[model samples]
Target: MTLATLALTWRHLPAAPPCPRPRVRTSEAVLLSVATLALLLGISQTTTWGWVDPRTLGLFAVGGLAMAGWVWLTLRHDEPLIDLRSAFRGAAAAPNITALLAGAGMYMGLTLLMVLVQVDTPSGWGLGQPVAVAGLMLVPYSAMSVLGSRISLWVGARISPGRVLPIGCALYLASTVQLALGHDHVWQALLSMALAGLGSGSTFATLPVLLVRAVPAGETSSALAFNQVLRYIGFSVGSAVGVTVLGLVSGPVPDEHGFVAAMAVNAGVWVLAIGVVVRAIAAR
Candidate 1:
């Protein structure tokens, strides 16, 4: 796949139009990288090291400081890694914030679904399915997401892309609620995945469109890249937090309550995302 991509790009990609070279913001880049890595590391290790451990606290502090430095430098620099001023404007900020929360919710749902099925039935909440079956359960999610993406395009054309966001978030919220309420039956799990996929598909597809429309043409790529970064950060944090919550609630084997708690958290995040997007649209 990598070679094919390379070959395709080499053969078919167009040359860039001549333009002045953009200056590299090396310090800002380094600070941003350090901040993201440190925060992710701190979150992931909290399950092993205990939240109060010196190492965990140190990482958190380092991440916070690095983030603060990055922001300060970005504000002062003529050509920073990211344009904080423009990015923070209502138009761009809404989609970015939505992406972060939606990403977290998406990962949390996936993790919980995978874990829920493989857990032994003896736990009184799991499906006791084999790993293969557990894996297959995600098929609906993948398939429905494609459909959802199409649906978002259709709906966006009729209404507006910004409005489409809340609809997607609402679907995700419903899926989480459904999963939280019932996951005992295999069909229930499958249904939840379907809904989640649809929601994710629509939400993810809409975010980029909204972001690009929000930013200047020259800054479009950078803005989109930053949104992706936030999304992945949310993914990392969500997966880690889901696992930690499960472990805390159900020990080595996850139980129904753990899944419920995780889903509840996921649902809460979606609710917040919906609110943010709606408010942004209203303000616009």
Candidate 2:
């Protein structure tokens, strides 16, 4: 779902021109497109990846290795299928930090959410959803990123998306806290999910707007793609942190309290992001 948002956001980004009749005729886009297809093929062929147990932690390691390969390859390209150079600390911290922090924080916070609902029967607060059903809960939120894209466009047509992004981030944080407070039924989950989606959706939409403002024209595509890569990295890290937190906590009946603890850790990200934006505006 988040993958879809990342794609949509990248699509909406103010793009750079294709190199004028490049000598090699192989640009970063072509390389990345091939890589994406390869990744998709790997995912689609997982069932056939036999010998290795599908449910084992080894799958996780395999996935990580795939990503590492992607990153490594991206860096190796002479023109870089996705430029890492632009992501340096050169620009104002607002865009740079906001992109990095939000990327990681969003992943971590969202990962925390899945566990909040999926903890075993012993955990009192869970919805006890099987893996499939639990996965479906995210469908609505996934749909919302498209909504976020629209919201960003509308907002961008007026004031800066920089202003809009913080607003979105705050709403997301509030949603996290509210969900932490607890839900008696699926509706609460739905509501919280919507709010959460709206917030994340908004950020996903707006960040590129912010990125374009902060980066130079030549580096736009690579910068934007890298921004997205950071987000994927964030999701992995966030999921891991959430799982780790669950292991350390008390058994069963994991309630609003558990979610809150996770949020407490995530809240620092928002604080740091807000500081970046604040300082950026102050410098302006």
Candidate 3:
């Protein structure tokens, strides 16, 4: 499946355009990578070591300081890794922020679904589905994501792309609520995942365009790349948080209550993203 998808996109992929050379700042790059690695390590281990553990705390501290230095260096450097200035100001800021939150919610909710369907029913809440069946249930989600992107593009002709974000997020919000209420049946879980895919597809498709429109043509690529970094970090954090939540609530096996709680939290995240997008749209 992955190979076929890559083959399909290969022909349509655009050739890389030439641009002026950037002065590489090796130290800054290393520092930023350190920050990212530290953050990932800290978050990923939270399920094993509690959040208050000294190692976790120290990792976060180091990552924070490193990130601060990286930001400071970027602001002063002649050729920075990311064009943070343009991204943080004006219309760019709204979409970037939305991407961060929406990415987090999307991953968190999806991860929870994976766990909810497969965990052993020791706690009397899980369906205890086999791994293969649980994974197969997500096929509908991937399908809908593709369809949602096409729908977003079609709607773009009539409605502003920025306006589509809240609508997508609302779909996600609806899915989370539905999952939280009932995910015992295979159909229910698949439906919730489909809705999630729809939201994620539209949200991801619109974010790059928004960044492109907000920044100078020369800076657009770097700006979008930076936004992608934000999304990746958000996804990592969400994955770690979801695992931590479920682990904390699990005994010999995970509980359905944990899944419910996690879904509810994600629903709130969707609401937050929707509110931010809507407010940004209204302000414009």
Top lDDT hit: 1
Error of 3 at 95 (Å): 1.5
Q: Which lDDT tens digits does candidate 2 get at residues 113-209?
A: 6665566544456676677766876887777767876886798789866678787777677766676676556666677677777888887788778
lDDT of 1 at 217: 86
**Candidate 1, residue 13: how far the Cα is off, in Å:** 5.3
Candidate 1 accuracy as TM-score: 0.91
Q: Write the per-residue lDDT of candidate 1 for residues 59-144, one digit (tens) a residue.
A: 99999999999999999977777898988786899989898899898998898888888887574778889999999988999999
* Clashes per model (N, Cα, C within 3 A): 0, 5, 0
lDDT of 3 by residue, 1-284 (tens): 99998988897888668877777789888988999989878987777787999999999999999999999999996668887776777889888888888888988988898887887674567767999988887798899889888888778768898888788889888888998998778788999989988877888888887788888877887888778878988897787777777766664466877777777778888889988888888888
Worst-scoring 10-residue span by lDDT in model 3 = 245-254
lDDT of each: 0.89, 0.65, 0.83
Looking at model 2, residue 183 earns an lDDT score of 56
Error of 1 at 43 (Å): 1.8
